[model samples]
Target chain A: MAEHAPSAKRIQSETDALIAPGHTLASITEKIASLALKRRTPLGWFVGFGISFLLLQALLYTLAVLLFKGVGVWGINVPVGWGFDIINLVWWIGIGHAGTLISAILLLLRQDWRTSINRFAEAMTLFAVACAVIFPVFHTGRPWLAAYWLFPYPNTMGLWPNFRSPLIWDVFAISTYGTVSALFWYVGLIPDMATLRDRAKSKAWKIVYGMAAMGWRGSARHWHNYESAYLLLAGLATPLVISVHTVVSLDFAAGVIPGWHATIFPPYFVAGAIYAGFAMVLTLSIPLRKAYGLEDFITMKHLENMAKVMLATGLIVAYGYTMEAFMAWYSGNPYEKFMMANRMGGPYAVFYWLLILCNVLAPNLLWIKNLRTNTTFLFLISLVVGVGMWLERFVIIPVSLHRDFLPSSWGSYAGTRYDWSAFLGTIGLFLTLFFLFIRFMPVISIFEMRTILPEGEGGEPKS
Target chain B: MRRRGTGTPDIHGVMAEFNTPHDVVEAAHRVHAQGYRKVDAYSPYPIEELSHALGFHHSPLPLLVLLGGIFGLVAVYGLQYWSAVIEYPMNIGGRPLHSWPAFVVPTFDGTILFASLTAVLGVLALNGLPEPYHPVFNVPTFALASRDKFFLCIEARDPKFDRDKTRDLLRALPGVVDVVEVEH
Candidate 1:
């Protein structure tokens, strides 16, 4: 076996260095599993969880008010029917795209850097989907009815969800995306869960971990099937991720409204989804690595690679913004031209310009090598991109809807307190779930981490 | 739990522990060459070579996933066709009842959903997992199999099994850390 050096200097190259040098398979397991198995809960976790829990309560309260008072409590009004609800729905779902991208797409590309981050990113995908589901459900005013109504269930009313409608397509896409992501995450966790089951000191934890482990014993036969299954999932998820956002964009593209109707929406929306998702991943990973003292696993290389993706996708989004304007003029349709003019200089002009600044200008700073590698700068930029993506959705939805072909129908829309409450509450819900996940589950995949170790590659050990 | 009425304890297998993946793979190759058909190896992560060493090259998981995806495509498309044309046909915007372009999105989703579900569930079913009381776990040191250590267990059910000889053969393998009997 190689000498287990604790103080070895990490390799400097970005491509070659994924995990820091000198980590043994055992050390990797100990480092990752110990976080969940540790007896003492960290104080920072309590503070973070407490704040998010409070926000979650606010979410529940907002839901209660909306359920009782109706969707009228939100800012939905004439000419601007979709308000924060749709904007947030799009934003949250878009944010989830990065998780799938990292887990599935990167794996297919044979990017070993994905190994350390895929587990938590998949978890993020699930949580973001969870947050995304709440908006459309409650936006209907009667979630109880909307629940059954959304599906093609046999009913005495003899009604079925319109197979042709983009909204119904959304029902299938988002639900399938959420379910597959969950299965992928759980399937990946089983072996690590077995590790935890074996490592748990307490009987209660042992049983809990044992059951979740599903009796995984790291058997060679199991690994054979598991690897094939995981690879096939990655294959399936690649197109599914692209299809999900495409269906989401069709929610607008399929509409006859000026700004909402564009063929560019599908690829544009998919790129923007990936762009936004990577930003959120950066937002979560930076603090997470710091808090857990996990600098070795989630190296600077990972952050730099993510920044490059953001830059590339950010440029694509910029192109998207440019195309929307050019097409508005090129199409020579009065409604399309008017929609573009209204977005740039009208009521919600501030949001449009700010989005340009955040999404276009902010990500351009990543062209600088130092800035991309800087953790603090990357985190701040990720936050900016997040806000920018939300603004992009905001500009697309209500801004475009507020003004149409007729001046008489023109009206502005704004979110009431309930709107803000619900939006922020979902953030709380996302963070709350995230905090619990980090607390209970392995933030990194222990088994996957082991694979990248020096001796993990099956060969004769160097003498 | 122990078997009743037998003076001798029920033996599951003899397991050899190794420190590195290479050692385990090498040991497994030697064991297989010795005509041990019911041998299995455990490691912290998937090693393609290790599986090949154990003579496990093909997995039925991909075929199952393909079947699952096909089922999803056919089933979802049929449901849409039946619902739209046969059950409750509504002419919205003069579009035909069989709007295949519109049906594509849901069909794609169902294909992925079913394929992914099958991949996960099928792998679990194939592995004979959720057997919490596996005989391998009877060995206390076996816990390290999920961490750093590598283990190769030749089951007693293998026709060529001779406890003392198997233990001696495993001990003779290069880099073998320890050899122990696994109890059922």
Candidate 2:
């Protein structure tokens, strides 16, 4: 039994080494908390933030022009009424899904590796949702009127938003998603805030963190309730995350458009959202781990696990594409067949093929063990997958809307300068928020990481 | 009852700091067994065993979340049904006014939103948080409680608490690093 014990410990250490060996609880806290506490501001942060800020200015400029010139500032018309606005909206929302999946779903599953990334990923989720809301709100033209009318508030006009409309459902899903995510993120931050408060060198810093900590004393009584509340939030967020994307997909699926009317939209869109989300996570984390020298905490095992998720979700997305093509021909619907044919061989065929290459073919490279562990390769693939997912939304929205049932109504759509600016601006907004978050908050959850220590388990440190 | 000083009790608790979670859990069990009812354990991260040692059997947060979810479902569904079928009705393609299928998404959202909000607020309320001040923070070494230290605090309010005796008992614990009195 004693000999077997050593081998068992060896296997566990090899397979499930979440944190590096030899880290005591104090070292873990100091390493993570010090990034936001003791570490001097890096020069790269300023350069990156400066570029993102300039892009944010572009986004603000675009919004100003859009408000002044009406909806015509973009390339929306009769047939392609949903252009860059809806495309970018879907793309950004899909990217936010990975964060929820990591923080909520993975936590529920007890994936210990999720601890190091969940904090920053949840931050990413909030920022991504922030970027997403801008497109649809601005696209409504009179956003003030839209805000007033879209909600079911008692008003002098005596009108209610159409409950039957998927647009109304979108409003509910997105707002709830934002609210719940904020709650979850803040709840997770409480203990870490306490840690920061205790560790801060200056009085002002202590007060700032102390207020955020809310006088968390880490009492057993409080941990009892905090654990329950956190678990419940995770349980609630799992379904909410799935529902948000499903509702977003329903915005198109509920319509009668040949390409958009499929019953598979919910699952397909959900899978694609996760795929895009993991891609975005990898894209951010690779650079983050490099910049901050967090290789000890955010280990290669974490990266490999994420890559495997991307591959699996990528395969699911590939299956969705195949099913769409198969059903188009199998159902013998001329419109569906035409939609598939047009997607594959029409004027926008390049985008369709490019998406297949990026989303499907590129991620397949991760199946190789050597490439999966290679940071540079993983980083490049993540960026490719991000672009591919954006193109998938573009292909689904505008490409499907361009050619209508009637030959006379057939037309083409292209994004104007405003459309380009709005899309790029959101990226700026996402990065800007992320930069501030990493600077001000513990990017990796400090307390949660402490729990992963071998000492936390009431056992001797292995190896 | 033995009195230490001739004034209102200025000490909050007798705090003993330990280096490891195992030591804290062991100390908590011993402290609790000695008939101290107002005992609490503090650590940088939650140790499930320590909570059990400190006699925390259950938390009411889950029930609050469940109730909040049910309330959200009923309220949102009622609003949707009332608006669509009663107050304002419009015939779009002659579809039914009570479109329950279409209402599912929003209802789900409402339930999750309300439940999550309740979970966070309920836990905070139950724990009496946003306190910004507590007697536990009065101990200088208590700062290490959020770093690497594990603490077993026997409050002055405890029936079995004797300042000198409790301090002596804490000092004798197997893995205790230091013992101090937390001020009120």
Candidate 3:
């Protein structure tokens, strides 16, 4: 035991309290669990939740109206068939990608820095995916049938979904991604729920947490199985993080539409997803860490690292934009060339430039190390980047669709009040779900955090 | 409301509380070396080397996920092949019935769908999990295992089972606070 003391000291200095220094494993458990157990919902949470709820209500109303009338309520016209619904769908799905990359990919790489934020990122993935799925469903104007129609089930009417269609691929891809993300999140939550169970004083808390914990006693044998399963899930999720988005990109690339027919959509879309995902992480995290007084847990280094990821992925997205333009010019295809011109100085030119500013120029600021480390700057930049990525989807979808090969069919489009409400409503949906999640569950991984403590690793205590 | 009982006071194991993670890990190693096979150590968090000392290596989860993915690929591709070519042939955009390139996306999706299911279900089945009732919860101080305490439980089912001898062995371990019998 004494011999391992040396190694214990080394581990302490190496992993240093990801939470506050001088905090024990007991303290970490207490602080995190108390946030839920004590029922001390902060004022910020109340304000945030209220705003989210109101917006969500507005969205639901808009959806109800859309269902009552038809797709005509949205600004979906002859040429620009896809509008805010499709654009918003792609945007939210892209936002969901970062969480998977952080939770699964970073775990496989053995990056311990991810431990602090991975839990929430996974929660973000599920919520964002939930928001993303709402679009394609209701966009059909007959969601009940669209949902059942997508599945290849036995029916009296011998009709089948077109196997070659990318939309069908999307149904499987998004649903699979959603289910896997949820399972992964819940599996990780079990041990942490046990912590909450044990510390809970009230009978109601005990029953709730205990059931969620599922008698997780942290037995070494259970841990062995848990670790192995977690790793397997991570390996399983890595490809999904790429493939789901690739299949999504295929939705556009598979299209015969001139601007969307490019081969680069897959990699470009994947990279853009990561870029936007990281920004969303930062956008949510910056305000959150401040509000929750979780600076010690989330840390400045985490923010900087996330910013660096945004910068790297942002550049890939920029390259994607550049190639889309160059290919349009190089191919000498009039429709493709016109698509580029339409994006640059056409009806939606303001959105295109804003996209360039937010996605391209905003990330360039991360080159300055100071800016990356600055939470305020990182937060604003991330928000800008998030906006830019959404606009990027808008530019790609409507601009291309508004003007096809035939000049007679060419027409610009705008989403109606319903479109804006639905889009705004999802923000409410995403935030509402997130706020509730933070209030109930351990926002950070209580069990995983202990590994960073000196005592768990047999490292010498630094202090 | 009171918790449910198993109706028999059958003793499950002898559990010893260890003050430090290092202490219990050392105890685990000694117990394993002394030829006690049904041994388990519980701690507030995962201790990497502790499980190795108890002789647990390799889970069959990866193999399960792989098999699931393989089956999914076959099933999905085959379903499409049969549906379009054999059952209900309908031509759209002049494409062939067995369009393998287009089928790749859905097949890829099916692989993920099945593989993820296998990962979750295989993990639960392998772990004997979602089990809210276990004898370990019978220990009075066992709740501490999720907080700051470390514990080692030696089951009565172990090959070398002797109540007095095991209690004596746990007591002799360094930094052990207490030892108590657990009932199922």
Candidate 4:
């Protein structure tokens, strides 16, 4: 027997004691099973999953009706050709931003604590992308013809997708973003799966986990391969995280839309995506830690770190808004100035205020150390920020389009019941996918977290 | 030294426990000096020096992803050009016969597709996915890997592995216990 070294003690208390060295599979399994049974399904998880499913169903029905009938089911008219659908598309895509940011950007910065939440965040990125993709495909008014958007296929229509068009850029960016994210998420799962595999007692469970682990022997060679691949993917994803949102923003920027035509759209959109993404991470993580018994693993320090990132991005988003206002005033274009005014002072003033409050003001609470570290307060603020970000998108899209050029063409567009239903349904879809993910997979990267633990003072990774 | 019924060595591999990373690095250096080639090191997190000490090699994943992305760019551009320019050249807005700029979206999309494909394929290939079995699960205590235990396997299959010598070598190192040979 190896001499027991008390070096790796995870001591929360003397009485509770550190985890015993070489704790048996039986004991771990028994603990997990007991925890699973003892712990109540978190209310947030219930609400998030339940509502997301319901909303998903409504979205499906709306899509069915839209597909069978036409895009007329949407409130899109001539000038406002992109109504709820585009807004949802942009919003969902924006929501996905935080996932990539958490998984990739933080990874590059050598922020090991990111491991605790990166897996789930990455999953969220994929699902949010799945949700985002639904809108653009349906928005085409002919979902079957989405392949047409892929290229100027050798069809009767002579138009290859206009490279000159940002919409086409979007199809590329979004699809790529979703695909790469999903890959990253799944690949990241392997080591953790091996952990689960090694931990499984039943032969059936063993087989299932064994297959997922993909014969991981924890060979130094394998680890080397795995680490390099992961780093490369992270590198690839870093650019993608920025580029995808930047391109998405260009969908508006490349056009003649006054407020959208600014040079700052790329960085601005990226910042907003990260802001929304961080808000979402908080929204999900706060409750998950309680539900999954991962508080120790995903410590308050982690939350504070995330909140700081959120606050920084929030400031950036606020700056972007300021720039837009300043640019509108400075550009001396009536339409540009008018669009800027419409965003802040027009009929969509409420939405604008909500956006500012949620994205800008709410995160400022993090400035206070106590507020940032308080899990419950952090969670509530996260939810507020999440809602605020959605409104931010709402204000950015329809509000801008609602009163475009001609006042005669301008009629205030309010979201119909269908729009609200679809939005809620999308939420349901996101939660349902999330719930399933948590139930099956270890939400934290067990392997990565071990690496992040302080070898000594200062939680610096042993490496 | 013992041999199991399966004709494999009955050594259960060395288990080195360390309090801090520096200790592990020092221990690795000592183990290396002892000329044990089959030994491995496990830690809670990756230690770059330890990885080097353990003789880690570079992964081929970056090249794979790069190629995948390049392929995507080419395929998407080619498809768009073939479909629009060569197959059905319909002039809109007095555009040129072959519009390269117009192909950027699809080309860009294809690049993403390729990159994503690489990621998935790279992961699958690197991890040896869909593998239904392995020998590590045979060790019951191995499950502690997730929570606390860091282990090293000096597999019997390694060319330098001599059950008696490897076990003797590992047993000599501080913090090492139960140097059992792992069988596949």
| Top-DockQ structure, candidate number | 1
Q: Which lDDT values do the candidates have, in the order given?
A: 0.91, 0.90, 0.87, 0.71
| Alpha-carbon TM-score of each model against the true structure | 0.96, 0.96, 0.94, 0.84
- DockQ-based class of model 1: medium
TM-score of chain B of each: 0.94, 0.93, 0.91, 0.78
**lDDT score, residue B133, model 4?**
57
Candidate structures ordered by DockQ, highest first: 1, 2, 3, 4
What root-mean-square deviation over C-alphas does model 2 reach? 3.5
Candidate 3 structure quality by residue, lDDT tens digits, A154-213: 677887778888899999899989999999999999899999998898899999999998
DockQ result, candidate 1: 0.72
Native interface contact recovery, model 3: 0.75
Candidate 1 ranges beyond 4 A from true positions: A1-16, A456-463, B1-9
Q: In model 3 chain B, which range of ten residues has the least summed lDDT?
A: B1-10
Q: Clashes in model 1: which pairs? A: none
> Per-residue lDDT of A1-463 in model 4, one digit per residue for the tens?
2333443333323212222233332333334433323335657667767766776789788778778878787787767777888888888888899998889888999876687788889988988998888888877877677786554455666445555567777877887788788878877887777767666667887777777777766655567667777787888888788889888888888777666677998898888888878888888888777876766566666788888888898899889888888988988999988888778788779888878887777778789987877888988988888788778777777788778587788876766666677777778788888887886677766666555433443122443
True contacts kept of 1: 0.91
**Superior by lDDT: candidate 2 or candidate 3:** 2
Taking all chains together, the TM-score of candidate 1 against the true structure is: 0.96
Off by over 4 Å in 4: A1-51, A151-160, A456-463, B1-45, B73-90, B95-116, B123-130, B145-147, B155-167, B170-173, B181-184
